[model samples]
Target: MTPSIMSLFMNSAFLAMEAQQVVWLRMMRVAAGGASADRELSRMATEKMQAAIQLGTAATLAAVGGNSSERIAANAIRGYRSRVRANRRRLTK
Candidate 1:
């Protein structure tokens, strides 16, 4: 065969191989989507629960009256703030 004809054939063969590879990659992505989706849902649920707990803690702090118990509530709020900072660092990393 002429060099030009052989080069064209080789290029066509490479294109077909690439197309097949792309199809397989898409199929694999679809197959793995189920587990990844489940993991994402679980992550979202955990974050929501954490937010709820933080809100509840804030509500407890607000519920304290203007008495001696205020000191204890203030301490709890400080602890909650520390926990929030730690969680932020953990999540950001």
Candidate 2:
């Protein structure tokens, strides 16, 4: 069950990466028109990459069982919940 859950998370992460990449590529097309646009796109891409890395790391930690699997899974769940809440807040705003 844990492995299956981890796989689902991993797949979702990959989808997020693909979506981010598509957005970044589209941004790059517009970025070519101005220096400021280029800079902003670069910053956005960097932020997205950092978020992907953080999510991937958390998933990896949760997958590798040890004395801390329970703790890691709990932390991952908390992170997921926080993200959901943040998205809801953004949508409401």
lDDT top scorer: 2
lDDT (Cα, tens digit) per residue for candidate 2, span 1-93: 243566657655755665555565556555566865676567657755776788669778667745256556556655654554443343234
| Candidate 2 pairs with clashing backbones | none
Write down the TM-score of every candidate.
Answer: 0.32, 0.37
Number of backbone collisions per candidate = 0, 0
Misplaced by over 4 Å in model 2 are 1-32, 66-93
CA shift at 68, candidate 1, in angstroms? 18
Candidate 2 lDDT score at position 28: 58
The per-residue C-alpha lDDT of model 2 at residue 3 equals 39
- Residue-level lDDT tens digits of model 1 in 35-76: 754664575468658866875676566566433444444444
lDDT of each: 0.52, 0.58
Q: Global CA lDDT of candidate 1, please?
A: 0.52
After best superposition, candidate 1 residue 46: deviation in angstroms? 0.6
